[model samples]
Target: MILPCFLFTSLFMVKLSQRAWNNVIIVSMLALIMLFNLSSNFLNDDSDAPAFSTLIPQGLLISTIEFSNAKVERVGQGWRIESKLSVSKDLQGLLDVWQSVEVSPFEENLQWGDSQPKVTVWFIGQAEPIEYYFLILADKTLVKLGQQTYQLVNVNYQTLIPTE
Candidate 1:
């Protein structure tokens, strides 16, 4: 609607050659595309928080290749690491690093920055897997459900390796 009015005004104000009009059209189209692209970045980052279901009532299969590079699973007795040894206090403490994993929403910017090796956890009965991502150099924690949305979760890296 406004385009026609603006075009009409531009046409009366300036008389240009056919080639110039074509160039103008191309430039305007490019500008619109650029505007949409820029706005989409904001739209994606401003999306509502992910809706993470309640904690799995059964158990969880926690796996990661990051700091500890440990693979843990809930066994008949207790947590098992690397599918062999039982979860010791040290190992248990390492596992506790992710215990505060929550699916709460984020109000501010939640942009997915530089990717890192994520700690993937499989909650029994959950359709989506919770993947925790963070930079070892940085202190923030980012999480994503499956492949859809990502959010900055409230978590920090703590040294669970007890001094022996």
Candidate 2:
């Protein structure tokens, strides 16, 4: 429908000898394309967040263990997360462990210095419900026992790791 309207208006403009109208049509098309691209980027991010969140298990105790400083970047991915945790205090004698994971770019055209994105972390243990938390930093932070859920918001391009 839009294409037909544009074509008809273009033809009418040519007949009326309105070159400026043609330029306006071209600019309008460009602007429409740009808006579509921007909206698509945001929609894609919003859609993916839920799928990732579903990967976490429910009903288990959870908490964030660590976080890092936000690192902004111009190319290749946006942020990463490093986590260290103690799952259960009763399950003592086990070594304290840390996991590092990379966070993909929220938007394909996301340039450097854009608003920071959030990172969600989930921990699922044997016979245990999933735990998660949010963090603002991108580096490692100490996590206590019995709290297993962690969520991190506004994580930049920094890497997160477990300290203990």
Candidate 3:
């Protein structure tokens, strides 16, 4: 009778151990799935949309970027920035990004107030400067043409005009 009791106890322990392992495996898989979802930028839905557009026009060299208060102009092979706010250390990289920046059509139509910040890009040999009204929000930067609005996918507000 004692031998039978001992055998029963051992089988119960084995069963509990197997059940605990199964639970652990399920929890691990769930954790992995959650991690993957968090790592991906789920809000960026226009992943398939192409970045390059005719906004700036290809092959044309940019001459100057005039902001509301700041100015960045091409100087020889490099660029010179004039601004009260501290500019990025990689000024050339920032300019190159603006030159060929990727943009997507903004979903909402925004009404511009009287004091909306603006930027004008002047290209070499071009007669007219391309003007764009910009709004810098917490999460994204929106650029407005005459009637259409676009979201700047590659760069942000602080990247273009850093406070620090």
Candidate 4:
């Protein structure tokens, strides 16, 4: 009976050690995976997709415009913002102004006339709705888009704005 007890105890101890080693390996593997992910952002991989701005989707139109980048939402089509300068009121007019703009990279902020007066415009396109951000600083405008940024030259600031 004594010999049998000794054999049983030894078997149990061996099984316990095996389970402990397996747990340690699993934990180590998980830690390595996490470290790799955290470092990926710093890699300068040119093939990476362009980072689009955080404009709301399903917002086929600009709902509201404020100075501080808040109070702006991508409201769906058929939504109208009836403020003093509302895009829905005269979209065709604004499009005309945008069409006249020369698409180029923004170089310098030369004009400072319209700096204090910031206007937010909600734009609607045939395919989708997006918010068009602009500084409207002068004859040229600094426009912010999701996929890219541009400087629209030789544009009328007031006509491009949405008005009631």
Each model's C-alpha lDDT?
0.53, 0.36, 0.76, 0.50
- 1-164 in candidate 2: lDDT tens per residue? 89969876776656544677778678879989999999998877855353332222234322332233322111222223232453222111111122322232222221222233333333334443232233334353212112332233223222232223
Q: Which residue pairs collide in model 4, if any?
A: 59-74, 60-129, 62-122, 85-162, 86-162
User: Residue 44, candidate 2: how far off, in angstroms?
Assistant: 1.6
- Candidate 1 Cα errors over 4 Å, as ranges: 1-50, 53-68, 83-89, 102-115, 135-139, 146-154, 158-164
Candidate 1 has a TM-score of 0.39
For candidate 3, report its TM-score: 0.59
Query: Model 4 over residues 1-164: C-alpha lDDT tens digits?
Result: 69857865765577557777677568758977887887785575646543322222333344444433223333453323334434344544454444455555554534343343454444555443444556654355566654355565555445555554
Model 3 worst lDDT window (10 residues): 49-58
lDDT of 3 by residue, 14-128 (tens): 7467677788568869977997887776765667764436456678888998987788889999988888878655778777667667778887967778677787889999999
How far out, in Å, is residue 2 in model 1?
56
Question: What are the clash counts of all predictions, listed in order?
Answer: 0, 28, 0, 5
Model 3: residues with Cα > 4 Å off, grouped in runs: 1-55, 85-88, 162-164
The lDDT, on a scale of 0 to 1, for candidate 1 is 0.53
Candidate 2 regions off by >4 Å? Answer: 1-7, 10-18, 42-148, 151-164
- Give the alpha carbon lDDT tens digit for every residue of 99-161 in model 1: 544444434445566555555567655676655554333645444444444343544434322
Task: State how far residue 92 of model 4 sits from its true place (Å).
Answer: 14
> What C-alpha lDDT does candidate 2 achieve relative to the native structure?
0.36
**Top candidate, metric TM-score:** 3
